[model samples]
Target: MRYKLGWASRFGVALLMGILTFSLVVTTAPTQIQGAIAQATAAARQQQREQQVRQVRPETYDLSRYPVTDANERHWRNVLWTTGVVEPQEPYVAEAIAQIVSLTARSGLSRPQQRTVEMAMQIATQLYFSNPTGYAAIGQQFLQTVERSPNPEWSAMALSALVKTGLDPQQRQRLGDRLRQRFPQWNQDIYLFTTLRDLALLQQTPTTPPLGDLLKWTIAPNQVHLYVICRPDRGVLCQTVVKDGNGQFLRENGQLWSIPLLLRSLHELSWNFTRGQTPQGIYRIEGVRPANMETFRAYGAYDLVKLFAPYEEGVREFVPGRPGQLPATLTAYQALLPPSWRNYFPIQQSYWAGKAGRGLFRIHGSGEDPGFFTNNNRYPKSLGWNPAIGCLSALELYDDTGRLQQADMPPILNALTRLGGRSFTGYLTVVEVPGADTPVSIAEIEAAINS
Candidate 1:
């Protein structure tokens, strides 16, 4: 039985083998097709994601404005970035970093000049997000370089860089201790106070507000008291807070003025001193002129809080016009001052140059009529974003409807009124610190949060 059917059975075996091979091919075809489709879908999704990243990337700053030949212009721009006046976009950051690196390889800059470059490097690195490790290394090197010198400016800048890099506490503490021991001869309390705050922050200890305390420490000995710290460069949009005698915040009746402030205009700069820029120091709010008053009405301000005349009282005059003028009144004023106070000007003039004016500066309502379109002028829009004469710090009252509201008036009025109505006693103390020739970065804010 076994021998007779062998050749015929071999044909059946071959047919069965062919059927199994066909079935295997049929099963695997769908798997191969599915894999191809999945690969195509993934590739399409990856392209979409890349497009999204490209579309949403931040715009680069215009580098042509900072030509390499113009060191003053470039340095000024660097100051702006360091102080948060102008935030450095990625391109600016990279450009600054490259400049610093190149400058480091060569030598010949003066100490102050070198400090400026180092400061710019600190600012650029802190703002940059892409190269944290590289930035940190540069910051460390900067710290070492500055530590060798006794210059507090360099020390302060280096400390700022360390703060921004989020240096570890133990290392930060050691550096801070060294800074404290090294720089007692430094005159500016800003350096000491700022470094103190940085040290406290690093060690996880309590820190007094650097600017607030610095202001308090400076003015504490003087007879004039401060009721509010009007920092037009703080908080959301901009925060100016009112403080009490103890330096505690006064929240009553909207004492906190959280509104945009207008700075300076080109036309105004021609005639008016301070160049329409907000002054950087403390000034006593000696008196107030009401809106009904003819003098202020001519100048187009609402309620006027007269800061202590940086010059002799009634000596400097405001020359009124479309493009206003300020006369050289300091010479006359110096004659009237007692010999002691007369010398004070020479010592304090640098600080008071911006603070002093020809006597028309005021925080007031916008000149534009709220309801009517007598003109197409936007007072607040111009003022808040930097367009005012030397005297005007215009408040924003315009609502989303383009109509001005009285809401802006209450906070300023309330603080002034509560202090003594038209006879408020303390300095107006308008500070936009760490900027506009005074350099402070928002990294201070970040350190505060970490603390």
Candidate 2:
């Protein structure tokens, strides 16, 4: 294997050479040469300073003094509802999940309570995944669900869920055969047709999504890295190398942003189902919500960039950034990708997820500071970052006195912003790439783009 130097190593070498050249020119070259060399060195130093400034990092805050207010309650409550935990009863599970997640992030979680919460979350998600189409009940319950449910949608969802869970073929089909007989007319139904077509896909051998020439990121989409954030020079994306699909380096107006996001949903359930982890897929960026209109303590001060799944909620509204209309069919949505990544299944998750009745995903900053909690990190890999109800959440730094300081949402919104201050009708694709514990670093992104 060829040995590779990291960004720091490469920079160190370049700095060394620049220093040596400057020393030689200053010591031995004539007056005019020395003056020219001095000017060049100063310009280079200024450029380096500006380049470092472009790689913006959010300021950290101490939140221990701030009390865990109703915002935390409301955030967890929303999570509970997303996980199908809504009821007249208090959301005990949400509390546990929140506690576990917070604890896990900053400090080690060895409490039995942590195990209890994990098991509870696991059970809740399992119940959701298994019952969606209704075969996990087995024997009488399974038969009755398939045969008796009047809703053809339920039956279709059940069969598709069965396919997704790797249920036995013969058993799945036996129930599916009954489902077909029950809903023979459902073949024409748009929702069922879309779902069952996706089910047929499960039977086929799964292919790995291609790492095309574009460094299309499948982020757990955090680390606040933007390849295209700009650098003052005619929109040249200064240092750091992540190329966009059009084979050009991207710029975010000379200011690269880092929005700490965890694609892992608070539910931490299966990706394909509703309220699961942020599914690996491409979504349409319609615009940023000018204001949340709710409590700022949960959502923060940044405007949320709204995301739409293909054919989401049966509406294809107009967007100013992209020409023509929204994609209505799978082929059209595939048009969202470069020709190279069209067949990649993971890249198309938002489409199927939308088909499965999941939407309302947005890119927003969080207000739930983990510093106030004891245990809340079973799912989010980042420190102090909170999970979402399937929305892409960016990190929000606040002051010790409970005031917002820095956020990751604004730059992303800025990147997607269009002429007339409209949000771009562009697409944001998230993929779960291989390599355990691997982050979407600049080198990795460059390698994929160059490859």
Best by lDDT: 2
Model 1, 1-451: lDDT tens digits are 2311221242233223323432222223445433323322434335533433343222322335543333554554444333222232344445444455344434566655565555454444334322455444445455664465444544555555555456677777777777767776543444444445535644563322345333333232223333222333321123344444454444434333233334443221211122323443444455565543223212222345565445424522222121222233545334432343333322233134433333455665443322222111323223222233444444433333332232243345555556444445444444443333221333443243234
lDDT (tens digit, per residue) of candidate 2 on 126-178: 34342433322322222444566565543454454445455676776576667
* Overall lDDT per candidate, in order of appearance: 0.40, 0.45
TM-score of each: 0.39, 0.53
Question: Any runs in candidate 2 off by more than 4 Å, and if so which?
Answer: 1-147, 155-182, 185-205, 213-247, 251-260, 268-279, 312-324, 352-358, 370-377, 380-383, 397-400, 414-425
Pairs in steric clash, model 1: 262-383, 262-384, 283-427, 283-428, 284-427, 361-391, 434-438, 434-439, 434-440, 435-438
Q: After superposition, how far is residue 337 of candidate 2 from its true place, in Å?
A: 2.5
Shift in Å, residue 354, candidate 2: 4.6
Which candidate comes out best when scored by TM-score?
2
Error of 2 at 389 (Å): 2.8
